[model samples]
Target: MIVAAVDAQNLVDALGLGSIYALMAVGIGLVFGVLRLINFAYGQLIMAGAFTLAYASRANWSTWESIVACFAVVIGLSLVMDLAVFRPLRTQSPATMLVATFAVSFLLQSIALLTVLKVQGQLGMPASTVARLSQAVTIWGVDVRKVTIVSIVAALVALGALALLLGKTTVGLQMRAAATDFTTARLLGISANRVIGFAVLLSGLIAAVVAVLLTARTPYVQSDFALHDMIYVLVGVVVGGIDRLWTATLGGFAIGFASGVIYGALPTDKTAYLPSVLFALVIVVLLVRPAGLFAPRGTSTVERV
Candidate 1:
């Protein structure tokens, strides 16, 4: 009975964790597909959105209103970043762009800390929001947080919408073309700004979604709220296969699921070892499949999203 109970809880946690990471992966993969840049600053979008939520909560805004504000702030910031920073440096070396993103990440984190620390004693969301999200619902005699179900549903919906956007729409076609070959696509009349801007918009939207779910699971809105999570998702993208969206998504889910299982198995006091074990496993996987665990043998490490 004890083992069964533990396994059931682990399964729930795994599904929830996988769902969050999968959405994050899609956002990262979208930007990567077009720009070929790994955006470390992506987490700042979530941090900004979370802070928006925290502010809304402080103002006693309704839940729905807070959610809307969160999305707006994240998407708006995303556009601004792309237009002001990334657009100008489009032709720069990849290393330069990578460093730029890292700088942006730190800048945003510092800004968040400086701004929020004075307003609130520390960075955090409203107690009511956390209590509401942490509320448990029992299913078949097993208990799970309401947010877990929401996370899984949101992930499925986001993935489905992404598939439709990529497979059916004209912009989607342009995006795929750009991903396949940015220079060739531009020469073929696809607008570089439009395609790339739209990609950033989509990533920002995903970040907003992540902010909501993450805030619910962990209502403490800190400067580093999404930083470590983003790092894990990045690793997952590399592990699963960063060349294609599906592979990257699967990789994120795989890493999250593995982490969930390891976390569930560990004693509370030993939880700090989770990262050490997880990274070790990642190293082993990389040693075995340097291209990627999911990447096909002999294939080029590039593809359309």
Candidate 2:
């Protein structure tokens, strides 16, 4: 009975974590699917939103106001990034574009760190901004965090809406064609800039949502807040199968769920080994599957962000 209860709790936590990670994977996958860029700076978008939320909280803004501010800042930054850096290098070699993103990521992280230090002397967020998200609710004699429920629901809603956008909308069709083959897409009269811009916009929107949920869960709003999660999601993308969107989503969920289960099962003192174990598993999986754990055999499609 004790073990069952523990397992149940871990399952709940895993589901929540999986939801968050899946959202990230989708965001990263969207950019990659269309742009063929890995976008190492994607996490910085989330960081920007989190800090926006923190600033809004400090200003005594309402919840809705803070959310609006967060979204605005993240989306705005994403557009600027695409226009100023990514757009200019669209025709460059992949290595060049990849290195450019690495530089952007570092630049944004450094700027965020210095700005926070200058303003607050440390990384911080208003306590009230996240306190309610950690509150627990009872369900079938089990207590679960409200944020977990929100996270799962938000992920589902966002994914569903995104599916509609991609499946039913004209721009989404263009994105799909572009993802299949950018050169062909351009040949077919699709506007490359428009398609790329749409992908970045969607990616930024996803990042904004992630920022809200993660901030509510952790509330620290630190400089490196999303960096570690981004790394895990990136690895998950590769492990699941970067060539396909569904596979990447599954990979993200799998990693998040595995992380939760392992963390819950570990002795508290030894929890620090979680990353080492997870990465080691990733290495083993890569060694065995080479392509990806979720990728179909004999598949060889040129893929990307």
Model 2: per-residue lDDT, tens digit, 1-305? 32443578888988899899999999999989887888999999999899998888888888888889999999999999999998999898888999999999999999988998999987655535656788999898777898899999988998898789889999988998998888999998999999999999999999999998888878878788789999999989899989778888989988988888888877788889989989999999988887788989987644443
lDDT score, candidate 2: 0.88
User: Cα RMSD for candidate 2?
Assistant: 2.0
Give the Cα-based TM-score of candidate 1 against the true structure.
0.95
Give the runs in model 2 whose Cα sits over 4 Å from its true position: 1-6, 301-305
> Model 1, which residues run further than 4 Å from truth?
1-6, 123-127, 300-305
**Model 1 lDDT tens row, 128-241:** 443477789999888999889998999999999999999999999999999888899999999999999999999999999999888888887888888888888988999998
What's model 1's overall lDDT?
0.87
